[model samples]
Target: MSVSPQDVEKVALLARLAISESDLPEVTERFGRVLGLVDELNTIDTETVVPMSNPHDMHQRLRPDAVTRQNDRENLMASAPAQDQGYFLVPKVID
Candidate 1:
């Protein structure tokens, strides 16, 4: 679980990060601290904890789904440069 300088270097390379030699030790120490925190958290027991989508026990109020706009397909399609059989046409992009 301990993070070494080599481990930090490898992680930096994999993540495409630029870490100078002078900062490698500091970066390794910080990474080790993060891992230690994770290890500490892993020791806690949560078998009795209930899974929840939100911390607050409340239901979201949603408006009823209803159509509010009139259909104007023909008027919209009239502005298109190219269209065919009620469908807008575009130049062929792939073979």
Candidate 2:
């Protein structure tokens, strides 16, 4: 899992990092170790494992999508800073 200086330089170019030549060796070593850890993880046994999106298995309860009457237009408009006719008025942004 040892990484060469050239490999580090290529990674730097791809990532747009400005790593110096002297620092390439250390960066390569660190990056190689990280990749080695991932390689080790790939060797773990999980053939019969089930994939999970979340820990909880309970589903959300859904209600009927029916509309209900709520005739309170004046109460709704009371919260607006400015209103004209039946629409809320705001500062003009376009010419």
Candidate 3:
């Protein structure tokens, strides 16, 4: 769980952080504390604990899947500036 100055430097490089030489000792100590906490958590017994997808046991209510709107494509296409074969046409802007 102990973190070295080099490890802190590597972490800073990976995170794209601008860490000064003076800050290395403090950063390394903080990282060491975090690693120690994680190491402590690994010692807990979870053999009887069940994994959960959600904290609460509940099912989501869903409405029946059915089309509710009438087909109005013909009325909609009449307002388009330019349309061809049921698709709106536009000028090519890219090569």
Candidate 4:
């Protein structure tokens, strides 16, 4: 897949990018290389390839879900400037 300078300019405009005229050629060349890589990947056969969430076949080790700390809400809330009904009160910024 070949990319022209005009195509890069159009893409830059659409993406709101500030690519200068001096850099346009370089950018276009790089973009063309990326598309070339994609084109190369398209030639690879993957009909027999199996889709997987992970490459490893091992199960994830998980820790037991248990409460490790006591509830200290009242102690923490004591330092708040204003709180009501177990909820911190904040000054309304919008009318």
TM-score of each: 0.49, 0.48, 0.51, 0.48
Runs off by more than 4 Å, candidate 1:
48-95
**Candidate 1: tens digits of C-alpha lDDT, residues 1-95:** 79999999898999999999998989999999999999998899978988779989998999889988798999999899999998899988797
Provide the global lDDT of candidate 2 against the true structure.
Answer: 0.87
Backbone clashes under 3 angstroms, per model:
0, 0, 0, 0
Clashes of 3: 0
Task: Rank candidates, TM-score, best first.
Answer: 3, 1, 4, 2
Q: Write the per-residue lDDT of candidate 4 for residues 1-95, one digit (tens) a residue.
A: 99999999989899999999899889999999999999998899988988667989877999899989998999999999999999999997797
Error of 1 at 77 (Å): 26
**Model 4, residue 91: displacement in angstroms?**
30
Task: Give all candidates' CA lDDT scores.
Answer: 0.92, 0.87, 0.89, 0.93
Worst 10 residues of 2 by lDDT: 45-54
User: Which 10 successive residues of model 3 have the least lDDT summed?
Assistant: 51-60
Error of 2 at 85 (Å): 38
Q: Candidate 4: where are CA atoms >4 Å away?
A: 47-95
Give the alpha carbon lDDT tens digit for every residue of 6-94 in model 2.
Answer: 88888789999999877877888899999899989889987888876778997778988887867788999999999999989999979
Estimate the overall C-alpha local distance difference test score of candidate 1: 0.92
lDDT of 1 at 59: 88
Q: Which candidate tops TM-score?
A: 3
